[model samples]
Target: MHLFSAVPRGVLTLLFASLLLSLADAHSYFIVTSPTQGTQLQNGAANRITWIKGLLDDIDAFDVEMSRLSVDGLILVARDVPAGSGSFNLFLQDVPSADDYYLLFLNSTSGVMFTTSSRFSIGDSSSNATATEPDSSAPTVTISGGPNPLNDFATTFPPSANGVAMPGWKAIEGSKGQLIGLFTAMMLCMAGGAFTLL
Candidate 1:
């Protein structure tokens, strides 16, 4: 017996079409490429936060947040940053000097964190030994939601042998190839259905 013989032709068509659509709508992963472990970022300086995309299409925008090991909350650094930009300029003028500062990249549309940077030092501990108050204009949010986004360090690709994160497009190409194969299979199924009707 045929595997899909029991299923109606219209139902099978809809199922295959929906599967293709879902694959087509897959979101890309953003990997932070800068401020890696042991890196130092000076406070009051315009530091650049860069990232690379992985697999499928990029999201419209994402939010950037700064957090510290000693700190108890997440600080909003930037919001609605365009995904295509691939980088953001962060100014920590009012932030204190800390060696455990890290960045978080969150999807702006869904408020879900996608990636994070390793803990790095911020500001010169010798120059600014005391903790400085954050900027009054900057809004702060407490971590009271479901899971802590800080603990989630999700990535599509593993670090290279040198411990540096590198981006690859092979996964994207593989996904495209799979989609094409599925499309071809769907066409064959339709043709088979037409022949059965004759």
Candidate 2:
């Protein structure tokens, strides 16, 4: 009398396979870790930008952008940053002093904004102040409900001087290594269950 008992065995197997394939196609994203809310970065100083990547596949690189809350456009910070490198060293020399600066990470291949960092302030180069650590407990500022931020701004901002690739910073093995291992273990368990049922 079970509903699934009425379905053919091959049809049930096809349905299960389809479900697994859909799960494997999940989209990837990045989470900015450093320069969180209320962090004060000094101009003309080298600051490390770090992020945690989630299930990166298909996208090979990212374009970093900076925008000010008071200004009306975006600034290109870096281009073609490798997807696997979880950290970038940014040297802010020519950037103007602004208290509402935030960073945007875009997918280079797709031109889509993947994530944005919490707002951080940049001080004047002449100031004798050092950059402060990010206040972890501060609430993040979210930017939304506007025209595509990239539409008005041209790629005029020169790339930052330091592009030091820290590939080992929080490395997550090969891009697809973890996913492949997961699929293999799942299939083995499914096959074992099938044999037991038979």
Candidate 3:
């Protein structure tokens, strides 16, 4: 009457152990401390490249390097922080001659996951570059008879909240014309089936 009764007791024990290992290995989340993405900083500003790492159960320590990709390999290494410190800090002074540079965390034994987020800049002027954000103010419009409205919004607006297909795409989603068209199409299909049967 038990659910895993047909399985061998040893096999069940092994499965439970495997599940525990996977849970430990699969836990990680990183967040930048300061000078957020696409932020403009002083020429010699030693911005602390600190990041909050979530779930540090497995990984004790790892090296963090601020690097930029080159034609051959990582070229501009502003800072390379070695492991083994109670508290760790990464700092960068001179802005790389290059444009896009990112932080790379390398932990072979434990937590080596790196951030693939868009490159942040350190420059004199950030007037032209705008920080990307989602539009959270608008009250979304919904089609009562169709699929969910939030899904429709996501399919239309991107994460940057830029370049929607049409300004009225959300507002006009529940318009009578659209509903009538869908209703009419369904009725016509039903009628065609009835005529064939007759």
Lowest summed lDDT across 10 adjacent residues in model 1 is found at 152-161
Q: Give lDDT tens digits, candidate 1, residues 22-130.
A: 6554554577888788777655454566778854454555667777777687665566666665665555554566688888888645777788998888765345433
lDDT of 1 at 133: 37
Measured by lDDT, the strongest candidate is 2
Point out the higher-scoring one by TM-score: 2 or 3.
Answer: 2
lDDT of 1: 0.61
Task: Itemize residue pairs with steric clashes in candidate 3.
Answer: none
Encode model 3's per-residue lDDT on 56-105: one tens digit a residue.
Answer: 43333444434445422332222223222222322233344345666565
| True-structure RMSD, every candidate | 13.5, 10.1, 23.0
Which whole-number lDDT from 0 to 100 does residue 175 have in model 1?
A: 59
Each model's lDDT comes to 0.61, 0.64, 0.41
Prediction 3 TM-score vs. true = 0.38
The ten-residue window of minimal lDDT in model 3 covers 139-148
lDDT of 2 by residue, 1-198 (tens): 555666776777777777666656555557898789877777666666778776545455677778888878666566666656666566566567768989888864567888899999877668766764333433222222222445433222334334444376344454455667587658856864674465
Which portions of model 3 miss their true places by more than 4 Å?
A: 4-18, 26-36, 54-58, 70-94, 107-118, 125-198
TM-score to native of every candidate shown: 0.52, 0.54, 0.38
